[model samples]
Target chain A: MLTVKHLAKSYNGTKKSLTDVSFSVSPGEVTVIIGPSGAGKTTILRSINQLIRDDDGEILFDDVDMRQLNRRQLRDARSHIGMIFQNYNLIEPLTALENVLHGCLGTKSNLAGMFSLYRNSEKTEALQLLQKVGLGDFAYQQCRNLSGGQKQRVGIARALMQHPKIILCDEPIASLDPKSTTVVMDLLRDLATNDGISVLINLHQVDIARTYADHVIGINNGQVVFDDRTAALTDTAVTDIYRKTTSSERSLVYEG
Target chain B: MIKPENQVSLPTQLPAGPRFTIPLRFRDRRRVTMLITLLILGYVTLITLPTMIPDHFKLVEAITGFTENIKIMFLQPHLSNTSWLSLLGGLGQSILLAFLTTLIGSVLAFFLALASTRRFAPTALVLGIQSFMAVIRAIPTVLWVLIYSVVFGLGANAAVIGITFHSVAYLTKVYADSMDELSPEAIETLQAMGLKRPAIICQALIPYLKPSYLSWTFIRFEINFADAVAIGAAAGAGGIGYQLFMSSSFYFDFHEVGVMVYLILAFAVVLEIISYRLRSSNTAQH
Candidate 1:
């Protein structure tokens, strides 16, 4: 479970990138945030982890405020939170399994992690996740050599390695192919449903959000305009968030 | 087909205009400026020559005598030859100083460069510090070494500090520029993945910078090595430059000076080749 209360962020003497927006997700729930470009969707996710400092707000993760935590405390608090990206930000020089192993690094002793003192259990778990992601044979392969789809899958497995209570995906499938897009979306959905991980994903694809999310939150210009159960939204209801622009380009963002 | 009428006749065509002709008729301002500058230089030299020096007749005679004596001396190689070991021995301290200082300066400069980079800087204050490093670089290494030779009590230690300080400035600029070239997308991706700042630099930025960094270091090393001689001589300390200085001051001990110059040039060339090879091998391996 996660709660963001009246969150606001202004980056470096500039206009607020995020306004007093609020949203919450229940345990094992897939909460999707859909917005046009520059809607502060990514900022919201980053703020929850305190990667981006919010000027005003409280992010309660299991009822503990993350914004108030100090450096070491924040680092420790981060183990329960896993984040992925569109770019599949694995250390390129590292192998697939070695990168997945990086997820456990926060909880493992820093000394042990630095010298690569991985436990047999952690290695087994990493290999198992790779298998679950259909990447068992590519464990030894360097991340740089992987295709976009495979890399995102490895990104998921790497996130899953944390055994996180909450997972944040900032357009994890935006750069992927249609087939790979569905596979990744389905995996996120399955994780939220089966693994009981609270997930908040930002996406441009309205159809994928509707197909996979348990709930949808629409954000526009740093504000959350709509939040509802995914099942409750009719086709017309979805249009209000995407109806401002008439160009084919605007429709492509949430065309379906 | 029997009449060969089916065979396609080559069509007459106007050739594409002037594919390889030089535009000789056109003259740009650049060419005009160059010609004017050359003419002025030639005119000034012609006017100044023969009158600039006092007693040209005696001067020419003296030069001729010096040349003949030098020629005779060179012909007898066994007479005034400086031993190879002594020449190299005098150069050792300067080379050692350059090596030590470059090692220290560059290592620190890398961190300084990282801190200075807009991408990695903790704050604006850090960026300001990187600029100050540029001021250090603007001053020549020889000048800095000369100053430090006095401030640091005039020796190879002074030479080392001076070289290190200057090398740091040069290297920081290189490092920072390379850091700037890193993809903002890559950095954002790393940060999004919850990696720490240090990890982001080590993981994403370092790999991209490795080739350029290695190349820059080798190039800088070669430069610094030559500078060692210059700074070494100037710093009131002993080096190949000091030996060269001594030989020159002693009046045309070409045999001794020649050997030292040859040795320095040879070592420098050898170092350059080794570094070039190392960089090539490193890139291939990675």
Candidate 2:
């Protein structure tokens, strides 16, 4: 389980990205965060894993405060938390398998990773994750050669390589095509069901949020406006959450 | 005047400033500056040239040392050394010195560069390491070599020490710049997956810097070839430079001197070609 309390982050000292924002993730729940741009959705997820330090907050992962953890302890804790990026941040020079092996950082010694002398046990595990993401055949291919959707699949597999308790996805499908977008969303959905892993995904699409998320949390202007089951969000409330200020106030998306 | 393309293009009228005050002369400044500099240099040389005539006169005796007819101005026709070991042995020593020094200095500079980069290290440590690197690079390699030669005593090792010291300075600068421009997103991706600083530095940064590093090392070897020539001149050490200096001092041996000059140029050109190949392959691999 993961808990974030009073989390606040700001690039400039004056402005707060997240103001007293709090959230918790159960062991097997998939929590989808929806927000307009600059609404501090990504910041909230990054802050939880201490990738970006929160100005004032406490993040507890597996009953240990993440902020209080030293470098090694933090690294250890981070291994249980995997993060995915919209850009598919795979190391370009490495093959897909090697890039996935990068997720074993907390589990491996500093010397082992530095020398790349560690056994292919983690590598084999990474390949299995790749197979789960449907990249089973392209393990040895360079990441640069992978298409956008394939790269994200690799990114997802890389995150999974950590055997993480939770996964953080920051617009993982924003830059993807429609088909690929559906694929990634479905994959995340399956990950939750099959592995019993918690996920915090940041997305802007209301329909996608409604379709894939178990529960949806909406943020507008850096504050959460909606927190409830996905089925309970009405058309009017969804528009309000999205801040689509149409003079006609017509629904932007058709709901069948 | 340009109705079609200009009208359709985005509006980008030049902003008024000191950036280009002279509109007609704004193509480039280098041409005009280079002309002025050359004129000034030429005039200075003309004025001070009489004082240098005596030095050229000394070369006349060195030129006349060859007994053969064509060898007078053509330089030494043969690599005739006073001692076979000194010539062959010195050639071997020169190569060995250049090779060893390049290896040592390049390795040391590489690690130091990695340590000093902000991207690869924490800011506090990077700043201190960066300043020290700058200080080392500030002093010319010749001075470092000269001082090191004095301290370490006059031998090939001293020359190597000097070469490595200077190599560290330049290698550090180049490696630091490369490391700074290393793909941050790439490194972060690795880190996000739980990779450490060293892993990212090696897998991501080191490979990117490889061609540049190898090119730099080859360049240093070429420089140190001439540098080794000059080093022996300073310390009366073992090298072709000592032979040239001593040979020219007693009797004018333009033939042997030409041989020395030719040898240096030949080796340097070969190394330069190899460096070019390295840069090309570096691009290919990456």
Candidate 3:
């Protein structure tokens, strides 16, 4: 489980990227954040991982404040919090198996990781994860040669390699096609239900979010405009969430 | 269905005096600048050519003498007078000098590059190392060798030390540039995975830089090889270059000069082949 309370972030000390965002994710649940571009969907995910430190508020992982942890403690905590990116963010020159094996770097000793002295058990698990993500035959294939879908599959396997409690994805299917998008979304949902791993995803596609998410949080202008069970989310509410509004119009409007 | 009043009119054609206009403000200036540069270079060459070759007949005579000397040197080489053992030994020494300097220089440069890269180090440290390398590279390798010879005394040691110094500076700049070309995302992702800086570099950055590093090292080795040869004679550093210098300047043995020249050329060509093979094989593996 993960809990973020009153989180706020501003890049230039001016316009806020995230404002007073609060959310919680339960185990074996898939929570999707839907927003238009620059609405701080990715920012919220990054702040939880401390990739971009939030200006205010606490991120609690199973009731422990991550902000209060020392460097060593934070690193240990982060090892269990896996993250996937829109670009896959794989080491391109490395093979699919090797990229998955990299997930063990934080857990392994520095010297062991440097020399790739991973134990046989670790390698087996990495391979299994790859197989689970449908990349068993392409284990030795370089990530550079992989298609967008394959690369994202490898990304999922890599995140699973950490045996993470919570997995955060920043538009994991943004660059993927419609078919691949369904496969990846399905994979994430299966991981949540079967593996009991909490999944938090940022997505721009409302239809995909509605299709995949158990709970959906709609964000606009750095604020959470709507939050409800996917089934309870009305078509009118969805339209209102994504409706184009200028700064002048925002001054005339208020949220209850 | 019958909403004729609500139908929108779309314009089919544009009203224009000129369909397209060329923006020539910058283009015309660039052309004029290039033309002026060419004209000045041509004029300078014209004025300097006569001074460069004071007499045409002397130039012709010198060329004929050079060709005749080459013919006599290669066709009727004084093989008996040349010592094969010493010549080979000198060649070996020159190669060893190149190898040692490149090895030492590349190792040193690798560390300096890591420290100097903005992605790895603080801004002040990066700027300081970069400026320091720039200063080292501004002075020619020969000048660096000469400076070292003054400090360490004239010998192969001085040549090796000086060449290594220049090589390090050269490689630092190149290696840093290559490292800078790596995508920040790779490192950031690793960092987010809780990897330490060192682990991230080993797992992400080094693999990306390996091919470029090898190519740069090989290129620097070739340069150091040439520098070793030059310094051998210029600083009395005892190598094939010294023998070549002696044969040409003191012994006036053009045949031996031709032999040495051919030997050096053959060595360079072989090195080129080896480098090409290495680069190609590396790319193929990747």
Retained native contacts per candidate, as fractions? 0.11, 0.39, 0.49
lDDT of 2 by residue, B51-120 (tens): 8777547665656643453564254345555665576566666777777877888888888887888786
DockQ of each: 0.16, 0.36, 0.42
- Residues B151-269 of candidate 1 have per-residue lDDT tens digits of 78877777788888888988888888888887786666544445566665665677667878888887788778888888656766677787777776765576666566667877888
Give the TM-score (vs. native) of candidate 2: 0.82
Task: Write one digit per residue (lDDT tens) for candidate 3, span B122-178.
Answer: 999999999999999999988988999889999887898899999999999999999
The number of clashing residue pairs in each candidate reads 0, 4, 0
Residue B31 alpha-carbon offset, candidate 2, angstroms: 15
Of candidate 1 chain A, the 10-residue stretch with the lowest lDDT total is: A247-256
| C-alpha lDDT of candidate 2 relative to the true structure | 0.77
Q: Tens digit of lDDT per residue, candidate 1, span A1-256?
A: 7899999887764666777889998999999999888878989988988878889988999888998988777877786688888888777767899888877766665465546678899999999999999899999998888999999999899889888899999899989999999888888888988999988899999888888888999887677878999987677767767656445633443322
User: Best candidate, lDDT-wise?
Assistant: 3
Q: What is the TM-score of chain B alone in each candidate?
A: 0.74, 0.73, 0.83
- Indicate the DockQ of the complex predicted as candidate 3: 0.42
lDDT of 3 by residue, A1-256 (tens): 7888888888877667777888888899999998888888988998887888888988999899887888888888888889999999999889999999989888878897678888899999999999999999999998988999999999999898888999999999999998999899999999999989999999988888888899999988778888889997789988878878686855543221
- Model 1: residues >4 Å from true position, as ranges? A8-20, A55-57, A108-128, A221-226, A245-256, B1-51, B57-80, B84-95, B120-124, B151-154, B183-208, B278-286
Q: Better model by DockQ, 2 or 3?
A: 3
Fraction of real interface contacts that model 2 preserves: 0.39
Q: Which candidate is the best by TM-score?
A: 3
The residue pairs in collision within model 3 are none
Better of 1 and 3 by DockQ: 3
